[model samples]
Each structure stands twice: as structure tokens, then as C-alpha cells.
Target: MSGSDRRRGVIALREESCTVCMLCVRECPDWCITIDSHVERVPAEGPGGRPRTAHVLDRFDIDYALCLYCGICVEVCPFDALFWSPETDYAEPALGDLVHGKERLGEWLGSAPGAAQPDGQSASG
Candidate 1:
């Protein structure tokens, strides 16, 4: 495929940006995306303000063995934390190795395509 051609690439996750909303998990037809998070209370910004709770990501894994490459999870990510990485050559000797965690997914972010421009032009344009 040419450089401009879009590939049915692997999924890349930005764990820091993810809100752990479970939208991707619920939208995945193959049930390949797994996420675990916890709620933590943070001190109020002001004296009269109530404490705020934040979701801390504990675990995020995607079983490529079960994934259909349908991009449902990517589309359902409200936080834009999920992306399509063109580096799809992640073949492994063992089937278990195909199940990638957050670290592995994050690595792909380096090679993933940049975000589109607001004027509907490709980043390269």
C-alpha cells in the first residue's frame, strides 16, 4: 500500500488520556478490549468545594487474537485516547503474546498517524 493509503492497522492506546469510561469495552463486538480502573478522591480546589473523584487506570489490555480489526473501539473512544497505528507487524511466537497491554499499545503511538487537521486536510498537506 502507498503511504497515503489507510491500513487496517493495530490499535494504539493513550492510557493517560483515557477516562476509563468503558465505551470501547462496551462497543467492541469481539470483546477484545479490557480495562480496569479505580476511583480516587482528590482534595477540593477551594475550602468550600467538595472532593473530586478521578478514575485511575490500573490495567488496559487488548487481545489481538480475539480482535476483529473493526475499529469499533477506536470510534467509541470519547476521549480520543484510541488510535490506529500503522505498525501492524506485531506477530509473536506464542498466542498469549498477541494479547497486548497498555505499555505495548503505547509504544505504537510513536508510529501512529498524527491527528487530522481542523480544515479536513491530512497532516502532511
Candidate 2:
């Protein structure tokens, strides 16, 4: 696929931008996105500020086996955490292996924007 065609290609995740919000999970018609997280107490960044609880992501996975490739998850993500990747060479020997964990999902993150892709869209995939 061409670089400009990532919207219809595979999915990539940016873990840093994700807030552990469940919008993608709840909005997915196929319920393919899986995430594991917990709340942590974050100390105030400055004096006279209040501490707050934050969701810490422990695990995040996407089951391509169940995904419809409908782009719903990508579109519904409030943060730009979910984006499309033009790399389509992913193939799993077993169906279970299609459940891509956060690390694998993030493999293509370097190809996110300004970088060129295998499709030569940017200049990174």
C-alpha cells in the first residue's frame, strides 16, 4: 500500500499518547482492542497543588483475529494514540499470535508521521 493509504491499512499504537481510556474498547463493534491498566496516585507537580489518581497502562493488545479493520478504533480514539500503519506484512503462524501486545503494536510508531514508510509515503515504516 502507498504511504497515503495507511488509513485502510494495519493499525499502530502510540503508548505514550494513550490515556488508558476505554473509548476504543467500548466503541469497537468487534471489541478487538484489549487493555490492562491500573490507577496510581500521582504526586502534585508543584507546591500547593493536589495529588491525583492516574491510570497506568500495564498492558494493551489488539486481536487482529477479531478485528474488522473498520477503522472505528482509530477514528474514535480521543487522543491521537491510535493511528494507521501502511505496513501490511504481519502474519501469524497461529491465530492466537494475532493478538498483538503493546510492544508489537508500537513497532511501527517510528513511522508515525514525518518519517517515510515502506510505501515511501513519508520519507519510516
Candidate 3:
């Protein structure tokens, strides 16, 4: 399989599906859920100066590199903005690349949240 066709194993969101409730935003222990919205704007003009198109996703990502997947972010989301999907095919050529940001997690946002993330997280046994 080509690297372009591979998938990420972390969770993310659906913008339209997100109600901007800030549930997941609050519950995230890693402080990873960065949300960009329509509220913050410069107030420019559009094609016809018709109150130019706003609502930009400046940042809506999870640092899978940092994400413990404690599921707190998923549990707190009242709008069902986040979720875990069946796809978990993330492979990184470098350690830095393995860190999943917002764009990558956006694909599988669901309504399911799991248990709390364990503290003192380390990959070692």
C-alpha cells in the first residue's frame, strides 16, 4: 500500500456535526483539542463585499503524539463532535510524524467517549 493511502489510528471531529459546545475542549487532559470557530474574525469582505466568508478552522487537532487517549475528550463532547473510528493504520517514518494533529483526527470523530486517561503515561512496561 502507498503511504498516501494510509490512515491514522487516533480520533477526531466533524465540523458541521460539532456544535462548538467545548465539552471535549474542556475535558482534554493533554490540552490538545484546539478549536477554531466563526466567532473569531477580522470582518473582511467576500466576492461581493457581502460580509466576506468567515468561520475558519485555524486549529482543530489532537496531538496524538501527546494524546493519551484517556477518552476524556470523547466523553465530554456534548455535540458528538469527537469519536474513535475503526481505522487505525497510522505509520510514521519518523517519531515526529507520528504525532497526530487536528486534520488527521478529523476523519473519525464519533459520539463515543471512553474511560479516563491514566496519569504518568509512559510507553514502557
Candidate 4:
């Protein structure tokens, strides 16, 4: 298969789309993903309504040194916040440098591949 047809690669995360649900952390076979969040109160929609609590992401980090590149984290994310980035040049001189933070992970979004079109379907179809 050609390069475009292959899907295995590093993960790209969208912090805005992530709800800090911890699904990715729980599902990771290598336990490479780490997330920290805190509950925040948001204004209610109507008067006298109770404020809604949401999880505000504080930290999201992935240790590439321990990752197996299995793509399980991407599959378990319900919010579509995780994706496969075609970029493969993330080698680091030290093991500590392999652990990427939220900002670094989000940067990979720019190189992430677009959603695949359905098989046997053309854009004009």
C-alpha cells in the first residue's frame, strides 16, 4: 500500500474537543496518556437554574517513550478529540523529551490527515 493508504502514526489531540473524560487514559494499553482536570461551574441557562459543572483540563501529556503506537487511545475517544498524525519525525535525544505536553500534541493537528472518504463513493456520487 502507498503512504496515503496507511493509517498508523503518532496521535494528535484537540484540547478544545476533549472533555477530559479519561477514556483514553483508561484504554491505553501502555498507560502512556496522563490527564488532569478540575471541575468548574458555568452559568445556568435560565434564572434560578443550578450552575453546570464541567471538567476543565489542566494537563494532558503523552509519553511517547512508553507508547506502542497501537491507536487504542484514538479509538476510545468519544469526542473525536484524538487523531492520527502522519508526522513521524518526533525522535528525541533524551527519553524525557519524548513526553509531549498538550500544546505540543495539539500542534500535530495541523499535519493530521483528513477524514477518509467512504469506499466506492466518489465526491460527485
Clashes of each: 0, 5, 7, 0
Q: What is the C-alpha lDDT of each candidate?
A: 0.83, 0.80, 0.59, 0.83
TM-score of 3: 0.56
Q: Candidate 1: which pairs clash? A: none
Clash-forming residue pairs, model 3: 12-105, 46-52, 61-102, 70-117, 82-110, 83-109, 83-110
What is the alpha-carbon lDDT of model 1 when measured against the actual structure? Answer: 0.83
User: Where is model 1 more than 4 Å wrong at Cα?
Assistant: 1-4, 115-125
Can you write out model 2's per-residue Cα lDDT over 77-123, one digit (the tens) per residue? 87777877766778899999889888887886665553344355542
TM-score of model 1 relative to the true fold? 0.85
In angstroms, the error of model 1 at 55 is 1.1
Q: Kindly report which residue pairs in candidate 4 clash with one another.
A: none
Compose the digit string of candidate 4's lDDT tens values, residues 18-99: 8999999999999999999999999988888888999999999999999999989999898878888887888999999999
lDDT of 1 by residue, 1-125 (tens): 78658675898877777898999999899888889999999899977999999999999999999999999888888887888988768999998989999999988876667644345664334
- Model 3 C-alpha lDDT per residue in residues 7-47, reported as the tens digit of each score: 33467565545666667878888786667666554554565
RMSD of 4: 5.7
Question: Any idea how many clashes model 1 has?
Answer: 0
Candidate 4: TM-score?
Answer: 0.85
Off by over 4 Å in 4: 115-125
| Candidate with better lDDT, 2 vs 3 | 2
Error of 3 at 32 (Å): 2.3
